[model samples]
Target chain A: MTLHIVSKSPYSSSALADCLRTCGNGDAIVLIEDGVYAAQTGSEKLQDFAGKAVFCLRADAEARGVAVTATVDEIDEARWVALCTEYRPIVSWFK
Target chain B: MKFTLVVYGAPHASEGAASALRFARALLEAGHSLYRVFFYGDGVHNGSALAAPPQDEQDLLGQWQRLQQAHNLDLVVCIAAAQRRGLLSESEASRLEKSAANLATGFTLAGLGQLAEAAAVCERVVTFGG
Candidate 1:
């Protein structure tokens, strides 16, 4: 499975949306840097990621003062590395 | 294991390129074989031969060139992205009627298919940039 990492904000670019379109069911999406904005409550961007596995970097979320929902898994640096090991073809979407 | 790196950020302007460079170095140090390093989007700027940074600052373009030479690495810049950013090779400059080409040494312009092929064959593909 591919691990799609989106580090750009949904507001600023279509990186997240573009990632969702190509990512498969088994693929995972991890939000980092400005991408933590998409994990905020009531974000329309969250709706697009409804059924897929979504994750947010814990450091990024805390830095942005955003709360991580139950639906989104908050991962640390070690967990991020673990995810990379578990998955292949780690794709990063940014613009 | 064979690995591929896809970079999407410009050098110096963003941390992406630096991070990728460090990671690539570490990967090699750890005995991992790199299949390719694909530059896409703004990452194409990393291949500009005209970039002249302050003498005191790190020359990221030069660093990449040295790394490519030392490792015998395949450094590919996406043709579509490179063209969009006005980074041209000798042939591309001739074809487009541009005055000169500024693509840095050790980097070649290719299609996105190269990325696809790398992803398909490499054991892992890591991306750096946002």
Candidate 2:
């Protein structure tokens, strides 16, 4: 499965939406930088990706003051690297 | 696993450089081998030798150089991108009749073929800066 990394904000860019559209059911999405805003609670931006895994860089979320919900796994940089090792065809969606 | 990093953000201006640096270190700490770091677009600014950030803030360019020294990291700045952004190496500066070269010590000005080759060979190509 591909690892889709989205680093743009859902509010400012379509990066997450575009990535989600191209993502397969087995693909995973990791939100970093401003993209971590999507993992926050009460955001309709991430209503998609029902079956796919979603993750947020914990440091970024905390830095941006985004309270990430349980729907997304808050991971550190090491786990993110581990994810890169476990996955293939890593795709980055940024504008 | 082998990995390549594609950095598209400028240092100090965008979070891409800092984010990519942290990720690079994490990748190395996890015992993964980094094949190359291809800096394209504004990310080429990370290779500027004259970037004098304040003593307080993070010195991203210096950090990248130190990382390169530690791991012999291949920091490839795109030729087209660097030229457009006025980031030239010593050879390119002299060849193009420029005044001085500002490309950092460890960063190499290369073509996009390096990125393509990295994508073909590396197990993963993680990108930063949007």
Candidate 3:
């Protein structure tokens, strides 16, 4: 499984959308930086990630004042590192 | 696991570079070997020797240099990207007839073939961008 890291905002870039187009089964997505905005409550962007593992960097979400939705797990830096170890061919979507 | 990181954001301009730095530190602490940190796009600016941010702001390039010194890290900046951004090494400056060199102490200018080799050998390849 691949770990797809999205660091751009859904509103500003096609990074998340582009990533989803190529994302396969059992892949996980981690939202970082402005990308955490997609995890905000009531965001329609979350629907695009349906049935896929999703996470948001806790520090990034808090710094951006975003209250991450219930479905997305908030992860610390250590967890991020662990995810890297778990995934093969980790990809970053930053546009 | 051995890993390679591709950085595409310049320090302070985007959070990606800072996040990459934190991740690099954590990976080391977790006993993972960093095969290389390849700087592409604006990431090449991280190797600029002339950056002088205010004292209040973080000296990100300096931090990278320190980490490189401490660990003997392989910080390679993409040659094509570095030249386009005017980030020249001493040899490059002389070759290109530029005014002076601005590449920092620890970073080396190389080609995309290095990235290809890294991806082929490293267990994992991650990217950080803004």
**How many backbone overlaps does candidate 1 show?**
1
Chain B TM-score, one value per candidate, order as shown? 0.98, 0.98, 0.98
CA shift of B60, model 3, Å: 0.8
Which residue pairs clash in candidate 3?
A: none
In the predicted model 2, the residue pairs found to clash are none
**Candidate 3 ranges beyond 4 A from true positions:** none
Task: Report clashes for each candidate as comma-separated counts.
Answer: 1, 0, 0
Per-residue lDDT of candidate 2, residues B1-130 (tens digit):
8989999899867798899999999999999999999999999999999999999999998899999999999999999999989999999999999999999999999999999999999878888873
TM-scores for every predicted model: 0.66, 0.96, 0.95
Candidate 2: regions farther than 4 A off: none
TM-score, ranked from best to worst: 2, 3, 1
Collision pairs in model 1? A94-B130
Worst lDDT run of 10 residues, candidate 2 chain A, spans A43-52
Going through the candidates in order, the fraction of native interface contacts each one reproduces equals 0.52, 0.94, 0.90
lDDT at residue B92 of model 1 (Cα atoms): 100
Q: Which structure is stronger by TM-score: 1 or 2?
A: 2
- After superposition, candidate 1 runs with Cα above 4 Å error: A1-83, A89-95
| lDDT (tens digit, per residue) of candidate 3 on B53-104 | 9999989898899988888899999999999999999999999999999999
Q: After superposition, how far is residue B37 of candidate 3 from its true place, in Å?
A: 0.6
Candidate 2 on A1-95: residue-level lDDT in tens? 89999999989999988997799867889999999988898888767756779999999999989999888999999999998887787888887
Tens-place lDDT per residue, model 1, A1-95, is 89998888899999998998899989999898788899998787788887898999887789789887778999876567667778876888877
